[model samples]
Target: MSVASEILTALRSEEHDPVRLLRSASNLLGDEIAVMSSFGAESALLLAFVAEAAPDMRVLFLETGKHFPETLAYRSELARFLGLTNVQDIKPYLAQVKDRDPTGELWAFDPDACCQLRKVEPLDAATLSFPVLVTGRKRGQASTRAALPVVEEKPDGQVRLNPLASWSADEITDEMKRRGLPPHPLVSKGYPSIGCAPCTRPVGENQDARSGRWAGLSKTECGIHTAS
Candidate 1:
């Protein structure tokens, strides 16, 4: 079996406990595991676990220039609230952004390419040294992630860990409440899945949490998660 498969098998019993899963992964990978966080709605839950289990673990945030001001504020507030010491803001290369999206309107004409330049490439560069990448993705957020597993090896041989893969929306809310964690400021404004301001919108009551992201387009993911 691959190392990721072996670790997944060993961690099966703790899959339901995100804190335990994170702690175990930290123990197993030492300094090779890092987390990717969007600091959007429900991000605090995973970040809280990170604070408790691995306070100093590198928490990478894709600081795309187009994010809502509220999201930027909340990112600072939550990191302070959670006592996270290593939250790194990963920004896209300025030269590439200038060359590919000179007008900064790429999100209007080609969101996929926008995300590739702003999020995917930056994240890929930020995580190059980490063999194990942890994320806050959950199955309840979108149909595309419905079958997400707790651990899987990517095509590049990197182990991607979705510690909260099976958590429901209610479970996330309850746990965050139980821990007294604050919600992202945009959540009250109807953004269940917040992203860059230009591409995100407010979804209706019955819509998927992630339906707000890239609203009219068929694009569900922002390329970072889908890319190897």
Candidate 2:
């Protein structure tokens, strides 16, 4: 079957749960797996799961350089705990940043341009070699992603599989606790949703986990999630 046919068929398959679906996809792709991780609040669960299923999977981290220090540190700690060997750090294009905006205040001025520079461009370089990428997105987390499928396609000629698409906040917490996984430092400090330092804020008492990200703004994703 063609790649498109295989993806469509897999999307309709009910035999594969989240875990089994990811494992099957890895096997189908000949073991070239790219696990894009943000090392955020609930990312630990995905890291742990992938560590167990595919320990050597290429864990891609888009190091936007503007990320919180805590996030970077937690990322390292989590990788060590999970025994992940291939943690690839995808960075921005130096020449573009230097030529376009040398002061690096692009994020403060134009967020869209900043995202294109850091998140979009980096992932474009990172996942080019992989046929499939596993994301830790959950449907219940956001309104836009409420209908996310277990498996979907990206416009970049590859598949974007949301293994935990059906998961909820409670489920994620339970799994993390059950596995004895430590939450990110900012997670318990009112910042249920942690992003880059400048943009991220503490969530309100009744706000969702992702409310802290791009707080007070209509933007939900950092362009990386919406990449086609």
Q: What would the per-residue lDDT of candidate 1 be over residues 1-228, giving only the tens digit for each residue?
A: 135666767666677788898898888778888999999998999999999998988899999999999999999999999999999999999999999999999999988899999998998888888888999999888888889998867888887889889889999999999999999988888899999999999888988999888988899999878876
TM for every model, in the order presented, reads: 0.95, 0.91
Give the 10-residue window scoring lowest on summed lDDT in candidate 2. 7-16
Q: Candidate 2 residues 1-228, lDDT tens each?
A: 125676557644832476666566666665555889888888999888787777777888888888889999999999998898889888898998897669988877777788888888879777777777888998888788988887776666677778788888898899899999989998888877677787888877877778877777788888887876
List clashing residue pairs in candidate 2: 155-228
Which ranges in model 2 have alpha carbons more than 4 Å from their true place? 1-4, 7-16, 155-157
lDDT, model 2, position 208 = 72
What value of lDDT does candidate 2 attain over all alpha carbons?
0.79
Winner by TM-score:
1
